[model samples]
Target: MSVLVEVCIDSIESLPIAEKAGAGRIELCSSLATGGLTASAGYMKQAARISGIPVYGIIRPREGDFLYNSDDVEIMLADIHTAKQAGLNGVVIGALKADGRIDETVVADMVKAASGMGMTFHRAIDHCSAPFDALEFLMSHGVERVLTSGLAKRADEGIGTLKEMVAFTQGRLSIMPGAGVSPDNAKRIIEQTGVTEIHLSGKTVRNSLMSYRNEKATMGSGDSDFAITVTNPETIAQTIAAIRA
Candidate 1:
């Protein structure tokens, strides 16, 4: 079977582009500048309405560390409910303890909240001390898939660990290699790691259309100043073609 390509999109505008590019699925979220936060209910609804493929809503309340507080858990649970109500096919979630282990309590609650929807544990597993243990934990908790870079900052650098993760899982759950995935490397990554699924942003920098430019002023604290990154359909198509080839 060909590898499944999933694009991480921050806006609903990317939905049609991704679908047109033959993306098998999409991970929907907001605040991509902060590494993606939970998307709003309005966005989720619009995404589901417009997307032809499955839309998995990301349930992250914020960026930075995956270790979430009680309030964060509450917000994530609420977001999961929102995703389900908005008719999303699944939800991507992750929570880690301060000690770099899966926060079983909070994760279980989120899983319960996502009872009938497809559930994927996000890259928070990369923050865990033991990838094997984390994989087992997620499997035991009924997670359908895991989006990870094999505990490394980038999937290409973590091919060894990713292969190990795929071998260890033994098909109990999917091991999806993500982060820095590109058309140039998708095939090699899939072959090396034996991962059936891959995730990428498939984005390119787009300059703002405003004619009046303010060189001194900035929008958000992050890199949201002038150029915004948007999904490139051609890039997504190339990635899919590479993986299929």
Candidate 2:
């Protein structure tokens, strides 16, 4: 089967580049430089309007930890509701217990709440106390897929575990690898893991030259120059080609 390239995008402005490059789908989020956060409804709608490919909204409220409070969970639920109403194809989300166990109750609720919408258990699966158990739990909960890095720092480092997880999943669930997954490494990972779906942010970050007239600038670690953009056609094409190769 051909590789499923899901480009992680921050805004609608990045659409043309992704589409022109032949992407099959998109993972919508903002501030990817900080892991990822939920994008605004207006942004989601605009993206859905322009991107012909299936767009999946990410449900992360913030970066840092996976354990979310009740309010955070409520916020995620509302975002999911809004995302579905916006005609988006699906959502990527994950929640974990303080002890690193799968929050079955929350996960089940989320699965039920997203009954009609496609739901993917996000990278939190990688943080589970038990990967195999979490996989079984996710399958039983009606999750469409689980994005993971085999509980390793990077996909390359976790390739073996990913392959094992794929075998454990059989045909029941989609075990997708993300984080440091590249054209140079995708083929080997896929070949070993036998996973059909792949996710990536096939773009590079360059400092925006446009100076901000509205906001004041401060000297800190966070700045546009320090920021990175995602729209590297060459890298994306190379990665896609490598996967196809």
Model 1 Cα lDDT, one tens digit per residue, 52-145: 8999999998779998888898899889999999999999998888889888899899999999999999888888877788889899989999
Tell me how far the alpha carbon of residue 136 in candidate 1 is from the true structure, in angstroms, after superposition. Answer: 0.9
List residue ranges in candidate 2 displaced over 4 A: 207-216, 225-228
Per-candidate RMSD vs. true structure?
A: 1.5, 2.1
Deviation in angstroms for 38 in model 2? 0.6
Candidate 2: residue pairs that collide: 205-229
Per-residue error at 166 for model 2, in Å?
A: 0.8
Model 2: weakest 10-residue lDDT segment is 212-221
| TM per prediction | 0.95, 0.93
Each model's total of backbone clashes: 0, 1
* TM-score leader: 1
TM-score of model number 1: 0.95
Model 2's lDDT to the true fold? Answer: 0.82
lDDT of 2 by residue, 1-245 (tens): 77787778885767768777877788899987787789999998988888888888999898887898999899988999889988898999888899998888777877777778888888888888877888899888778788888889888889889988888888788888888888889898888888888777876777656676433564445653545577676766787888887
